[model samples]
Target: MKTKHPYRLGVDLGGTKIETILLDPEGGSLGRERTATPRDPDGPTEYARIRDRVHTLIEAALGKVPHGHACTIGIGIPGTINAQTGRVQNANTTGLIGHPFQQDLETRLGRPIAMENDANCFTLAEARQGAAKGYDLVFGIILGTGCGGGISINGKIHSGRHLIAGEWGHFSVDPEGARCYCGNRGCVETKISGGGVAQSFFERTGQRLTLEEITEGYRQGDPQCRSAFEQFLDDFGRCLGGLISVLDPDAVVLGGGVSNIDELYTLGVEQVRRYAFHERIQTPILKHQLGDSAGVIGAAWIGK
Candidate 1:
């Protein structure tokens, strides 16, 4: 379908901030703005405040476009929309849970909108113009305070029938491991996410260390840090290798805070090869080129 507007507007509603960007047809950014997400003392009013803040941000961005021109809007949320109930689900921002977010936003904005999981938006951004550009199948993973994954095929997100296609974080990797918030035991997120790494370090050394400190200690050859970091790398390999055995995407792009570690592409890839079924694993696992902007950029492309 042809776009009805000269500008594309993308909004990324993150836990701490709301970011909006305007993009022209050639992918040049026309304007961008960000503001703190509103919070309310009352739990019930927080959602409404957030909604109003987002509306204000969108209106501010729209003011940058020519007066007579229209614009298409897309939004990337931390969670997926429940296809059955048409409500937001699995969002870290608890206020949005079970809310008619899309309907409310559309009613307030007075226009049709495209909404997608942020992970899928990241994948779309990478596949379209970032590290995974030109790849037919791309898997994008975010390793921050939490872990999440998304898939893009032929430049389009494959959200699957249940809208959980690339939710690799919840995959049960260990039946005997700690319970996840999702009511599962030994989920992949519990093993390799930033919080998980810190938890493992604390369990091993009885001293709480942030993931950054643990990584630094490992570099200094601290035995305790080494042990935990090694376990992390091995688990990363095992989980990602097992995933490769299933989908075997053309490329894998890593994003979020944890992807900054340079060793993952080297040591982590080797580990993936060791656990993968293939005799030779040649897939290129790359760092995101668009960085933090990928989420909003991908959200913008949803209008395309």
Candidate 2:
């Protein structure tokens, strides 16, 4: 695609890390930067440090742009900025919950920038060129430590009127399920997310274990792990199945850490079909092709 700007820059601001990418007009990578997300020793994060880090990263990437070439910057945030207030909300990273993140960044850089929720970025990238390519209506799922999702129609992000179109994970399912960061009692996220799985497992067995360890233990015939993992799959089915019923996208692509679980495609998918509204469900649930690069790359494409 021909771009109005020769140099395009994008930032992927996630809960665990912050990454930046610079791309040429043809979408070739020109430069990249990544770092651990800032957090204080007491476990709470500082909004100032995060804001400054984003500023510094953008500045560094801007240095590589040719002097005469025009540049555009876009950000893929873990949460969406409220259109009314320009403040971030529903971020997994709690500290960013109420800050006017985009406004602050624009003030810092002395220019306007494009921004969208990270899951929207994920769906846009996939719908344009990745696993969900050619699908008119694509649903992108990010099953990481926390669950998130996005929607893309005809390769363009379908950010809803309120800019919360694909925030699928926050919808409460069980009235008595695990607690979610969004103050919901039983959000889909609190059931199928990696963190949610771990928390559920801890409650069940009174043991602390990572998602990897729990799955490994299940593979090794550990009774407790098997029980928890089976329930997890069922929960995955209930959640995704319900969403599929609602949107009925042409294709659904999965990304993030939890998407790598082999059983999700087989056993987990079977559950999706069983619970789905259609008697002959045909949604092609797929694995991501661009991997972690999708978010940042999509962000670049979004900015004019």
**How many steric clashes between backbone atoms does each model show?**
0, 0
The residue-by-residue lDDT of candidate 2 on 70-116, one tens digit each, is: 88998998888898998998776767879998889999899999889
Local error of candidate 1 at residue 6 (angstroms): 3.8
Highest-TM-score candidate: 1
**Residue-level lDDT tens digits of model 1 in 1-304:** 4446468899999999889999976688998888887766447898888888888888788888777776888899899999999899998887888898988988887888888999999999999999999999999999998899999999999999999999999999999987888999999999989998898778767999988888899999999989888888999999999999999999999999989987798898999999988999898999999999999999998863
Supply the global lDDT for candidate 1: 0.90
Which candidate comes out best when scored by lDDT? 1
Regions of model 2 farther than 4 Å from truth: 1-5, 41-45
lDDT of each: 0.90, 0.89
Estimated TM-score for each candidate:
0.96, 0.93
